[model samples]
Target: MSSQLLPRLAQEDESTDALSGPQTVTRQARPLRFITCGSVDDGKSTLIGRLLWDTKAVKEDQAATLRRDSTGQHNELGLPDFARLLDGLQAEREQGITIDVAYRYFATDRRSFIVADTPGHVQYTRNMATGASTADLAVLLVDARAGILEQTRRHATIAALMGIRQFVLAVNKIDLAHYDEAGFQAIAREFREIALSLGVRQITAIPVSALKGENIVLRGDDVMPWYSGPTLVETLEKATQRTGQSTGFRLPVQRVSRPGEGFRGYQGTVAGGSIKPGDSVVVLPSGVEANVKAIVTYDLVRNAAVSGDAITLVLDRPVDISRGDMIAAIDQRPQTGRAFTARLVALSPDGIVPGKRYWLKAGSRRQRVMVRPVSALDLATGNWDDAAVLALNGIGVVELDFEEDAIFDAYETNRETGAFILIDPDTLNTVAGGMIDSRRSRSGRFDALPDADRASITLPARLIEAFLKTEFARAHVGEIRVTRGEKE
Candidate 1:
């Protein structure tokens, strides 16, 4: 694969007319990215291993090693342990549990797939979120013997919050349930209710036996004739890719490139909308306006570029531009403020500390911010509870106070520009992944002032004198004015 900064196109569009010329051919759909998650011992690894085995993704040498590893163990059908194919680590092999996220790739005649096998242990929930963050769909496994567990609900909630709209409830180990159709139905119905509560409408529940190779890549007509639905592979091949953002143009400048003294260009991927030559653009924060002179790419000079295309942008006039400054359409600009509210998943062991200063990185910008937790999400009951701090694997709402003006959009509107991550300054480790909820003004009085009269507004002498005595005023105060009414 090319190591380009361009985003991958979800799908290609093709059209043809009989009178015009020869028929146009449709391009192959991009590989579908999906994740398999549930509670520990839920057979997640087995399901993925079976899928790879049946699809001929495993080589002969790998199969021989699996047989050797399972010399003393075999399923009822005389098949070697399927989990061995994925549990590559020595610790994982000995414990028979996944500790880290394992990614595997396979393909069918119609389409291709990239699947992530995530850990189910409660402590590894953060690892699961890391896998699901980029997945377009999720495959949630449930043991037929044990219907729905707390971890099952937790994974579902996190997947939905990460913007995965498509779900597949795999009721695995069906053979252990005597292939009872009622048991499968009950589990499927319960999961559907949970999915519905999360505003997820697209879901498909299927009965599967990963150990016996039933209803994975092939139908289990011999065992359960009642299931007339498609196999797991079929559902995946027919699923659709997640749609991109429909918002206006946004390009967060990554770097400034000057190959020669007279040439200057801004380099970054188009995060949203399309851009073309002569289009009016604005440099945010500074509010400098300019027109596009040209669009430059490694391949050729293009007239237009859409979302996901990485290209260099040349402006018609010289203006101050640098990394982290956004180049956006003049008419539709993102929110700019000093404070904002957000929802984040706490990933570090120390969790998110209240009133602690950390580095908040969004797009290409990184700035100092203080985080305060307001509420914690109860994944089991789908309710928010009062919280002062977020623990490991905890999800909560927080208030972020920034030292400088920040730009963003609501995550529900455009994920590319609305998502951010918090880094611990001391350790330089990522502590949380957050989504922008809304913007909040730092100075309420300043925002309430009329735009036309802001220049004439003045502070009271008493208030100014008292403020100047404080440490915050000494560090942040730039200008002070005293207002006095005319003496009568």
Candidate 2:
């Protein structure tokens, strides 16, 4: 590969941009992060290696070592075993499978990329979730010979649940299938059905032979001219970043910095909407109100701060705020509750034990929680089946019982504040990764009254009986209503 290809890859077609209209202005070129995942021996490493090799991201010396290691294992094109580039672990090489997540960084002329090659075995589904949690897109590879396997659906389901909308189905090993276009289309159609059922709207399918370096970096027009679409590199450069949280300002206090006797600052990353000086914010759980005094950073005092920024916040008044408490917008605050419902992915060997106490960590807060599995997700059928316990690598819905008042937003509204991990108290290992679906209460009461006020409010017996008789109220009523009599 020549270094000259770099300039050629970076050059965009002027006509295409003009036809598409003006491009959105970006402050910086944030690398598009993605992950490659699917069943074992699906050519994930080979696809990534082909991408790096054709783009000249691999140095000559590294290629020389690959050639020496390959020995008699070179393909018909005389290329070295591309899988060797990513199988860094001795165990992985010996087993001929990816056992852990392998991350690789590479850049094209137009954009940079960070790709995580995740393991495909069912036992390592937790590793796949870890990579997909932060990815903007997921590239799922399927063997041309084996259309859609159980593990393929498992990866897709996990990726979609992690909030990845953009998907690329690379039908790898076209050469073994005689480069049959019909075979590729059949697999693409079946996968599209599964993707749509999972609520994924954006999908792109491509046919390629990773070992032969076809339709990966360079187009395989000579082999399959009938299939005309952007190459794998083009799909990545054009993909957009995940949208920011559309909720009100949120800052989960990581630490209380008290450098001086009279000065106290809350330090954390902005998890939601932007915040500015003088903004009225409320401390969660305690419900103490404070005004933003200053937005402090290492560089200087910033006028405003948006999501993804790590900074120190100074409140105007002395308030009872501490680590694990969330500082949110005064009017639009997140839900505070003692119980909630969430979807969890079991990550440990022992799996999730129902009615067991575990430490749940979300953002900077850690609290004791008891988990009760309600139902498990059927990946193949996209159905929820009754389950009493979640096994290893199993995904299920559960009820979370918190020992204290917990503050959180729906995972769909804010990924940062809604995501959490469960740790086993005895083993001290991560047992599950969970996302908050909604808050739940035994009494079905979610009013904003104080604990004392709630205890005092009582509903009339007649009103309760009448309300329960109504058809609409029977299934949906979750709150008690009471009104005082008016003076005549």
Best by TM-score: 2
| Tens digit per residue, CA lDDT, model 1, 1-488 | 11222223222211101011122223245678999999999999999999999999999999999999998888767899888888878999999999889999898877788999999999888789889888888999999999999899989988987888778899999999999999999998899888888777778788999898899998999999998766898777766666546567899999999999999999999888788999999998899999999999998999998878899999999989999999998888888888899998999999998877899999899999888888998877878999988999888998888878998988766778988989999999999999898997565433322223324545676766787787765654554345667861
lDDT of 1 at 278: 92
Model 2 scores a TM of 0.85
**Poorest 10 consecutive residues of model 2 by lDDT?**
1-10
Clashing pairs in 2: none
lDDT of 1 at 207: 92
Q: After superposition, how far is residue 232 of candidate 2 from its true place, in Å?
A: 1.1
- In angstroms, the error of model 2 at 100 is 1.9
- Candidate 2 per-residue lDDT over residues 76-114, each given as its tens digit: 888888888888999987787888898988988778888
Off by over 4 Å in 1: 1-27, 441-461, 464-488
* TM-scores for candidates 1 onward, in order: 0.84, 0.85
